[model samples]
Target: MADNTSRIVYEMTISHAEFFRTLPAVMGALPYVVDGSEVSALQDTRRLKINLSPEGRRNFGPIPLPVTHVELGFDGYSHEETQAFL
Candidate 1:
């Protein structure tokens, strides 16, 4: 257990039907600032952002990771729509 190679696994199971049932409400409450073409709780490849870590430097060496904020198509649906979905 003390070895650095030790790994931890997490497993959570939710039925597909249940997953979709709550997706709309969940999406409506989370806030993201990206201007994506479409905004939905659904997993769309075009809407996701790619964040890379600042690793592997040849000169000054590595520094602390900077704070990051992810932008999205927009903040969830809206207060009214979110309430209805919930």
Candidate 2:
């Protein structure tokens, strides 16, 4: 078995005001978890950069990665990197 100690925590936030006024899409975004903190919005970016060492060789697949890894000043996941990540 592989060790599970390394963790990645992402966090992003927007004022309630931001989602209030500029909301033609927000009306249809409720069904999804995109309030206060979330991912997969309306944008475009194909990237999957994972660098692991021999000691950290493990599978991160079943794990639900966070969207806060995107940092800030970006939109959302308009596209996903459907590459062979194994």
Candidate 3:
């Protein structure tokens, strides 16, 4: 077990609900499992705080090259659960 804590800052233009769903997939692709407790989502501001681990670092292996910015398209997933919580 390595006590390695890393911080990754990503600029994702996604809604709050969409981010909740997509985050799992994105984090899953990383080498480490995200510590949800340390995850902070500020959708209103389009900001996300993710506390990563060694496995995450190993999996993601640093940020992408050139660091191109892109927009994410959200489907019905955003509204599907809206009414449930309301």
Backbone clash pairs for candidate 2 read: none
Model 3: per-residue Cα lDDT over 21-59, one tens digit each? 666666443233324424544333233345422221112
lDDT of each: 0.31, 0.29, 0.36
Worst 10 residues of 3 by lDDT: 51-60
State the lDDT of candidate 1 residue by residue for 5-84, as single tens digits.
11112222333344335545655644433222222333322222222222222323464322222223312334443234
- TM-scores for the candidates: 0.24, 0.18, 0.28
Minimum summed lDDT over a 10-residue window in model 1 is located at: 1-10
Badly placed stretches (over 4 Å) of model 1 are 1-11, 29-46, 49-86
TM-score of 1: 0.24
**lDDT-better candidate, 1 vs 2:** 1
The better-scoring model by TM-score among 1 and 3 is 3
Q: What is the lDDT of candidate 3?
A: 0.36
Better of 1 and 2 by TM-score: 1
* Native-to-model Cα distance after best TM-score fit, residue 31 in candidate 1, in Å: 12
